[model samples]
Target: MRGFLASSIGVTCAAALALPLTLPTASHAAPSPTREAVPGSTQSLALDPLETSPGSTSTRAAGAPQEQGLTRRDVRPFSLVGVVWDDPDAQLHGNVQVRTRTTNTTRWSTWQDVETHNDDAPDLDTPERAAGGLHGATAPLWVGDSDGVEVRVKAEEPEAERAARPATLPKGLRLELVDPGEEPPQGSRAEGADTGVIPALDKKQTEDELIQARGGKSAAAGSRPFIGPRPRIITRKGWGANEKLRERKLGYTKTVKAAFIHHSASGNNYRCSQAPSVIRSIYRYHVKSSGWRDIGYNFLVDKCGNIYEGRAGGVAKPVMGAHTLGFNTNSTGIAVLGTFGSSKPRAAAVKAIARLTAWKLGLYGANPRGSTYLKSGGSNLYRKGKNVRLKVISGHRDGFATECPGRRLYNKLGSARSSSAHLQGR
Candidate 1:
């Protein structure tokens, strides 16, 4: 029944659904040109020619003008904010940060850095495969629950470095403010409604009935770790994913060998009930704006310990996703929603990651905490085609020099590993 429930969500129509038809129009416009769910109230302000300067600026060149890059001020009530820019050539050389004020408060926050080491584009060096829908971006930052905000991007390369560059600033800047909804949408996706739950024994009983359905293979293979029971996953349809915006045709690679973990980098200010709509907004941002074939992560986990399917292709299949950069091939990406730079990860979210990796990684008979060799497709950490032995369930930062999965979340990987291993009966 778990597998049936998971696959049942994918039984969508042949063509993609139109935007307005599926979207729930609340206070804001559809965040994406495609469908959007009324998960929360969010407003994305585009950077244009402004008459006044942004509230403040830092990390900029000495004596630099305030009009160096994009700026937005006096925004609506929001707890989280993210910056998006258009730089297809990756020529943008600068840092982007947002400062915000809490509701009914006069003080504003210090500018926090957004993660930018995300170059999830497929390596172009290999002639056999070329990247698709590549978009330049920086990870979103969490500013806690807030109301008013200001955003600025200082595009100042070192004076020495600017002398040899064409342009210092990234073009087309936009600030996205996300406010967690006070209540779940009346008709939100049913599957996501069951948040903070461990599936009933019927799910396990279903697993027993379908043992052969998952491919009967022993856990012993070349020193492989024991596999665990498949965890119940909320499907794209269950999360209200509009398939029309993404690639309809299925794409696949071979068997999964490793799993790389990531934080959605969107902030921790969201309610688990809003996860579906948040995911829909991300889907729109990725496909329509970011120019990616689909959402980057193969899977996404909510704070309530709910696991949602991400990317196209079957969840059980080795779907090729534009995640983990150089390690896209032979690996799967699992992203936990919300920022974790300073915030502590929820125990439920950690347990969900453990249950997920235990089953997904175990399919290949690999230990959750063990190391596995994956040839570097391309990464800043290793050269192309280098056979690097990475943790079977590795953090995104481990593969690339990124502050992804945040420092706080990264620190919790040991617990996640041990829990996953335990779930796998290690």
Candidate 2:
């Protein structure tokens, strides 16, 4: 079964770590829709199970079920795509890909792969998790500005003898089409009436934080790393977010002890002009369709190297986010806005990451190049309740059994950390 909404005003709407995390104070913001959300469309594609009946064309040998499951769906013009199957945590051992029509003419894009193993998520007991929302899902795929779309999911078979196919593919599959609206004119937020996400603090407040951080008096402890000066981050309001679709309150942990890195997994075909729309699309998808309180990452970086505030919590506070399963506690999740699996991460994107981390991590006195400890909440690699020590600036793959931040992008983490440390005066 599947659900779709087109250019409509409304719609619907991971991971764990042990070691009870203490939350800190929170601040919230409000924003109006930048443009009406792009019209929506929904699709459900039927997949052929592997090892067909005798005389049937099969992608796999007769007894191989792993190669059996496959599915795809086609939908009208939309900016973003998200896939949801029947179970939360149900693993689909396979590949997912999409190709789009770049022009009404015959021009078609080569197939693009969506990150399949996106298990990096917040702990189960969290509010978003308790809502019984997305247990398992593929990362959202962003195709360059396109009008037509299609997707395919194939079940993967492991080489090891011990690995076996589940009795069946996930029972239900749904595809969501999102139209992130047009880019707002530059400096739209300067108007008093601008409705994007509100800044967590006014200039006066931010100035005070800057003063405290520079003097190393914000959080004083021998073991505590010094907070670097706060970098300029575009607030949720700056991005023109719609506050109504999500629960408009802030959620926070006592302090951000770690910074988990991620790629939006939404493809690299977007223009900087389309960033706010991309964010809005992800925002609505995360809140309405995916059943989460808000966007999961604490901050988002664009390929153009622009930084946007993600989630509603004040940018200055320790807002808890639903990113990096088993390690969200005491951490901030920073997601770059496009897929990086097969492509190299943009240098601007990498620099934006370094600047953002240097400032945000500095607030808590964490060294971007150092390490932090977090317990596991049962990921593909970590058993529940296991104690894990991770780097202050780590990729999503370090904690979960998934290939996130992509190979090309993940390779750049070393540079990102070094740059961040340099920015923080480390």
Which one is best on lDDT? Answer: 2
Per-candidate local distance difference test: 0.64, 0.66
Worst 10 residues of 1 by lDDT: 11-20
Model 2 Cα displacement at 254 (Å)?
1.2
> In candidate 1, what are the lDDT values of residues 1-426, reduced to their tens digit?
434434323221111111112323121212222335334555767765434346653423344432333443566676556666666546445666667787778888777776655555544443213444455666655566577776666565556765664334566666767654343334444433133122322323423423433444333334333556666677665666666666554445555778888888777767786787677666666665566767878999999998888986655556667778788877889999987878888999998888888777765567888998888877789888899988988998888877788898889889989998887677
Model 2, residue 168: C-alpha shift (Å): 3.5
Cα deviation in Å at residue 318, candidate 2?
A: 1.1
Tell me how far the alpha carbon of residue 142 in candidate 1 is from the true structure, in angstroms, after superposition: 7.3
